[model samples]
Target: MKNNKPKYNSIIDAAVQVIAENGYHASQVSKIAKKAGVADGTIYLYFKNKEDILISLFQQKMGQFTEKIEHEIASKQNAKDKLLSMISMHFKQLAADHQLAIVTQLELRQSNKDLRLKINDVLKGYLAIIDDIVEEGQQDGTFRSDLDLRLVRQMIFGTLDETVTNWVMKEQKYDLMKQSKEVHELLVFGLSGNTHP
Candidate 1:
């Protein structure tokens, strides 16, 4: 198969770092190219513009992220374990990618409303994974019957997002994976059909 993927993945990676460090408003094509170790013209070969670059990066990384999570959860039979695996995978993935963590946690949010909306599309994969977990939990009678799956999904994502963002802002001084179990407990307690251990 043709390795038709971007000949300049390094450029995309550099763009991510540049955007993370410089913020979207301040990020420039020249800067990204420099960081990627390519001429500025090379970026145009793979991307139409800065916005396209950002969108592509998110879509690519998040897709791989979802795949890994899907594989991890598939190995578990219990919905509760699957849900925990899902959360753990997400936190661990972002935690390991410090540059990606910076871009997602802070810089990406700094984009304009239109850009944010586009970025939201890339995030749908992650969101859908959470929704699926909630559905599985409901089906297995582990979650509340009256639960608004959509709202519950948002709550789980929001809580986890906030947690990771705070840790990043704090310079990631602690272990992200170690904290995953506690988050699982909080979400499971509030949303699960049975609150008691």
Candidate 2:
């Protein structure tokens, strides 16, 4: 497919930078094309419109993000360690890339309903990674068997998401990666069945 081509990759990367810098509405196809070092018409060859470019950019980056987390979690022996690794990497990745942080936490949220739906569809793959970890924890007694899988997945995803969004909103004033351990501990404790304070 067109996505497999090198120019498509360039366009996607360019879109990320352009949209991050210009905001989605302010970004023009011409600007993206220029940034990509390709002709304006060439962008059309791979993407239907600016919206398509935005969606594709998210898919590409989020796909890579999920894969990296999956690989990092794979090396850990237990669900708890996997969860910690996922949390740490998620924070580190976003903190390391401020442009990506703005695009994902702010620009991406400004899309219309239909576009947001498509973005959510792309998010399912990343959610599946969390699902696997939650299920593993339940089976291995690391997490409460009584807990709902879907809810736990949401909690984990939402906690990580809100933490990053908060950092972005604060203009990255503090160390985002430093909270990974505390967040991981909070999430793990929530997943546990114990009633102790």
Candidate 3:
């Protein structure tokens, strides 16, 4: 498929930077091609259109994001540490890439309904990581076994997602990574309860 070719990846990377810098609506195929060091027509060989480029970019980046998080959490023996690692990785990765932050938190949200659904499809892998941690925690007693798994997953993802969105909105004036531990504490032990783990 297109994923195997170097130009495909170059185009995806270029699209991220172009979309982040120009805003998705303002970004043109030629601009992406220029940034990618390829001809404009070359893009069509890899992607069907600008929207396809955007979706592909999310798939490529989120794929790497999920893989790194999985590896980082694999080293930990407990679900608490694994969950913390996931949070840290989520914050740290976005914090390290400002352009990517803009593209993900701002530009990506502006996509149309069908595009949004496609983007959501790309998110399934990351969500699965959260599901595994929650299920493991519940099974091992590190988290409240009585908690609803689906609700817990939504809560965890929503909290992390909103935290990053707020950070992005603030122009990253504060340290995103610093908030990880506190967020972890809140998710693990909840607002009012005995700390577990």
Best by lDDT: 2
Residue lDDT tens for model 2, 95-189: 99998899999999963999999999999999998999889988998888998888888889999999999999999999999999889888888
lDDT at position 80, candidate 1: 81
Q: What is the C-alpha RMSD of each candidate to the true structure, in Å?
A: 1.9, 1.6, 1.6
- TM-scores, all models, native as reference: 0.93, 0.95, 0.95
Over the stretch 52-138, how does candidate 1's per-residue lDDT look in tens digits?
888887877878888999999888987788878988998999989988988888877743888888888888988888888788888
Better of 2 and 3 by lDDT: 2
> Candidate 1 — which residues are off by over 4 angstroms?
1-6
**Model 1: lDDT of residue 192:** 73
Q: Write the per-residue lDDT of candidate 3 for residues 24-137, one digit (tens) a residue.
A: 999999999999999999999998999999988998999999999999999999888899999999999999998998999989996389998999899999999998988888
Which is the winner by TM-score between candidate 1 and candidate 3? 3
RMSD of 3: 1.6
- Candidate that beats the other on lDDT, 1 or 3, i.e. the better one: 3
